[model samples]
Target: MIDWNSIAKKFKEADAILIGASNGLSITEGLHLFADNAAFERLFGDFKRKYGLGCILQGMMAGWPSEEEKWAFWTRLIHHYCGQYQPTPVMNDLKAIVGEKDYFVVTSNGEGHFELCGFDPTKIYEIEGNWFTMQCARPCHDTLYSSLEVAEKLSAAEQGGHVPTELVPRCPKCGGPMDIHMGAGQRMIPDTAAQARFQNFLKTYHGKKLVVLELGIGWHNQLIKAPMMRLVASEPNATYVTINLGEIYIADNIKEKSFGLDGRLDELLPALREACEA
Candidate 1:
């Protein structure tokens, strides 16, 4: 359990809140990346039967048979997760805790839940890109565009787990195949403008009472986790708090100032909100 009073006190005393989130909180909010259930089977039975695919990552891999198959799968993936997006209690709880606080978020989540949950778009840095946008897959261009029109068409028109060939997205600039602007691999592109905004936030409030509230940080990409630890370690007035169900560690210097709450986010988030409110 976490010290609710201290948590509340730190939050109140902090000059600004910096949130860094990974996939654990996302799964608890229903954007499951490694889905293994009847729902996945119902939607991707053909993919499973033909390719023995067990997870969404497998389908998004480089060896997915053909562009047709790849586009079909991507359409469904974006449709279910992004096009039909819904915010969960965890997002609402976070919003409650951040209520009227000067805050900024740098998240790797591509699902755009922060915006859906009513966080200020300008204050949030979607570092990993978003599912609702597309970019040239051939590395031909750096521009990103809204995929809402295509996502809607795909959701409405895709049948038997395949999107219409005419609806398949192609880069308008080079006629190359387009990919969702998600940071899953080396080709992943980051939003430079948003990165600049985040840099400004850091520059403007460097030595203040900053609290790094990290949630569900994973081990794969060091984009969020590594930088978060470094930032907290550098600032003596900073406090680091993490809500992760698994291993959570801190350096010798930051140990006393850090807090850890090990538990499932879906169960812990609402309770955290209650504690903060009380």
Candidate 2:
């Protein structure tokens, strides 16, 4: 059983809150990357029909006949998801719970949720690439560039489910196709700034009053999960809290230092928020 008040108090009094969020948390925020449901159809029905793609993940991987069609699909996706940054109740409640305590987020999701949900960008480390940025396929330069303007234009100019060929974004340095800076390909440039932030996070809170909150992370993506677990185990003052819908568990040895809350994020977040209020 989860001691809600205790978890709340941990957050309330901790010197820092370190968050490791993955696909589950993204789903809770209504950005399901791998889901093919009613909302998928409602949001991306056209792409599904035109490209025979079922989910965002499939549509992204599907090879299009033309760059125009491909970019059309991509622009709409980025615009619908990342272009408009809005705050959700979960984010609001998380902010409320943190209440100005120092926090750092290391997210595998590239949906730009942290920034949109009011989390400071400087404190976030998006290990995966973001939809709002682009890089040269050949990586002519070592830098990543913002693609928000191009995506917005393509989204606005889409007609009959495709963008104009002229609207297709290309590398400024080299006339090559631009790709989202996600972790899909080896060519993807890792965010050095985010790396620095993570190092700083570790340096600042290595052995103090820390709470490592792991939400919706699975074994497949263990970059953040593995490190966070090790941190809690290594630090005597640290506590680890895990909230996973499926396969939720904590090591028996660390049970005293950890709290496991098994349920959907949508269900668990509100419950925990209420607990904090109580």
Task: Check candidate 1 and list the clashing pairs.
Answer: none
**Model 2 clashes, total count:** 1
- The regions of model 1 sitting more than 4 angstroms off are 219-221
lDDT against true structure, model 1: 0.80
Please give the lDDT score at residue 2 for candidate 1. Answer: 61
State, as a TM-score between 0 and 1, how close model 2 is to the true structure: 0.93
Clashes of each: 0, 1
| Best-matching candidate per TM-score | 2
Clashes, model 1: 0
TM-score of each: 0.92, 0.93
For residues 1-278, write the lDDT of model 1, one tens digit per residue: 46888888888888898999988888787666688677678777788878888877677664655556677787777777766778787888899988787889989887888887788888889877887777888768788888767877777777765677787888899998888787335787778888898989887779999889988986454889888888998887889988887867665667888888788987777777787788
Residue-level lDDT of model 2, residues 1-278, one tens digit each, is 76798888887778999989888888888888888888799878988887788799887777678878878877878888878758887777777766678999988888888888788989999887787788887788877888778888888899877788777888889888888777237888889988998889888987799988888998555687887787788888898999888667676667798888888877778887787677
Q: Output the lDDT of residue 139, model 1.
A: 67
